[model samples]
Target chain A: MNIERYDRQTILKEFGMEAQLKLQAAKVLVVGAGGLGVPVLTYLNAMGVGTLGIVDNDMVSLSNLHRQVLYSETDVNKSKVVTAAQKLKEQNSETDIISLETYLTPENALRIIADYDMVIDASDNFPTRYLVNDACVILNKPFVYGALHSFEGQVSVFNFEGGPTYRCLFPEMPKADEVPNCNENGVLGIVPGIIGNFQALEAVKMITGIGEVLNGKLLLFDGLFNSFQKIRFSLNPENSKIKALQDSYDFNCEVSVNSITSDDFLQLLAENEIQLIDVRTPKEFEKNSMSFAKNIPLSQLEERQDEIIFEVPVYLVCQSGVRSKKAVNKLKEARANAELINVDGGMNEILKHAIKY
Target chain B: MEILLFGIAKDIVGRSSFRFEEGDEVPKSVLELKQKLNNSFPDFGKLSSLAIAVNSEYAQDGKSLQRGDEIAVIPPVSGG
Candidate 1:
């Protein structure tokens, strides 16, 4: 296919022409083109990975240039996937880069992921992460998991060769507030570049079977400390129970349970009819938090087993409201008599006047 | 127990590692150790989703910790 182009890697004893041939036949779908996807696609193309699909709904901004090196000032405000595909095509004419200019929604995840041999999770948010995991789980495709925050990042391979999945390692999703996204918490430009390079390596390893892919092992990279920790994780059958793709990241709730608008949430807070529990961590709480809210981080919610007053409804909230919805589920399962509700949009809405249940 | 922290766990604990000497005031189990940390640093409570590692392997909440057990708090990260 492209043996001559990959001769440098093909010459290696471990990664000979056989591995190069496998890489040429491999079809990979990368779910984001922000920071991680950019380098991942670049390296994969350089390695001559045959079929590459890119999914992204975001447009490049001036802010994207620091880390997303593929885009330029002229490319600002243009579609990320489109720009990525064009750049990658120019960089490697042998690799076919297909650009899908849309967000990876649950409705479209399976169809897109099914068309690929494997998926690389380069998304920046939790919803897409969970969606991609479930889609790959259903499709029975191996996925390279990559996530980063500020100076730290994690790389792992899930569902490959019957190893553990992302849900196996992370049973619960952290509240959005607890997560230090690159946008708010701020990440060094090199953080994702390093992590993305690892992801590309993992994909190449998976495709060519050249090296030991990080299956069942979670690799954490702390850019600040320049340290890497590879932690092994056992398969958790209980956590791998994904029968279908979920509509929301709210723990597969079919209906929003006792969800209240921000107006009603504040009104209840003012009237003292409802108790507001910010499920975000105390560090997040200290950073411009709602004064009326109580600081009960989700991790310590188990200690609040006896503190629940069944009569007063407890409203749970986090950054984007995904974690609060999870808190609501946990409370509902543990305390049947307790009335637990979720405040939609979490602090994002609290910051903005408009809110939804 | 000198508990080590990684990723967002470090942000919550404020330090990379802290000692939790076994005693009446100290914790004997992983769950208890987490509760103690949560009390000291309320941010630890936010990481309800974190996994604990004793020595090198992952330990369950029910796993008991000895006096010299090396502990590390692991937090899930999402950025890229």
Candidate 2:
């Protein structure tokens, strides 16, 4: 092993040569190679975590450059795990890096996660997050959880040291569509960096047994206000009682990925059978909206929901796709018992297709 | 009272902090505070749960809010 490469951390009394060896023997899997995965890979590789597996199906895109720091302009259009693996291998010759250039599906999650001692959940989507959590629970491996939205980031460790699992903290999944993701709400670039650092620290602490790991607790960081709060939680026990892994459900249908193109949306409108629910604010609907659409702003949706006529399927539209997604989730939560799909691009799609302002 | 919003709560309210004037609706209990937030931003109800913290400690629904307590709304985050 290259002792000089890890001289800084090994010199500490808690993390001497013995701890270095422990890191050398550890294997960790990091899901998603986007904003959070960048920092996680950098730290674990630099710290000489023995065998690291990187799994990501996404390719480097121009939009990812802001937060996914590991990739450069030249690396765009290439496989993320491949590019990340090459860079990580160069950073530390003593550490072994494996690149799994595929998405973590239920078919592959168990097989891939079974080989690692610990898993770092850097996934940006809900379905994958739940999948990782459930898989970790069944496998009996502790996983570090990190999530960032807007200016806030949350960090926690699930199924570690007989502590609470993710399900214990979050029992039911949020109606897939209502959850506002960074793609639409927008994010401050540094937020994920801060949260990802916390995730990496948790992993190092867990492996070295040096400091307190977030067990049955969550650390919330708000970059805008510059405050940190730790929230404690008790295990639900029922959430942790997963006897077996279930079938993998597709995120698009189960969650909020149901999007119909402007042309198709207009075609459906012409049929006049389906109900059109405008989820935008009253001002937005007044400014521009379909002629047959009912203007039920998202904020006032529940109070005015009787207009929905639950027996029929509903199509939702907003300024952008985000609000419409939220409207679908709201309807689902109310158990309206009807199919709700968002207009693919919302008003943006209509404007693009020139279907009418 | 100023409620510090984090995660998706900020997105729903479109701000980092929400201030309540003396005359403005001052919710005495955590549940009332949440109901007030929901009245303002109906999307708040969409989240599975919003953990509240007062003076850096987790506050229960029945916990009373003081005049100048540090309150934070921790909404669930899924972004990486």
Return the top candidate by lDDT: 2
What TM-score quantifies how close candidate 2 is to the native fold? 0.75
The lowest-lDDT stretch of 10 consecutive residues in candidate 2 chain A is A248-257
Q: Summarize candidate 1's per-residue lDDT along A1-357 as a digit string, tens digits.
A: 655777888788998888888988999999999999999998898888999999987777676799998999999767788888888988889887888988898888988898999999999887688888888888889999998877788899999988889888777766555666665467788888999999999998888877699998888777877887777778887656677887766443565677887777776666575567888777677764687778787778878756656677788888667667867877888887887888987875665543222
Every candidate's lDDT: 0.81, 0.82
Interface RMSD of 2: 1.9
Q: Model 2: runs farther than 4 Å from truth?
A: A249-357, B19-29, B54-70
lDDT of 1: 0.81
What is candidate 1's DockQ?
0.54
lDDT of each residue in A1-357, candidate 2, tens digit only: 888988998899888998899899999999988899999989989988999999987777666789989999998667889999999888887778989988788899889999999999999877788889889988999999999887778899999978888876566556555666676456788788888889989999899888899988888887867887787876767877786766753434556445788888777666767788988767567766778889887878889988887777788998656678768877888864678888876775676556243
Residue-level lDDT for A132 in candidate 1: 88
Window of ten residues with lowest summed lDDT in model 1 chain A: A348-357
How does model 2 score on DockQ? 0.46
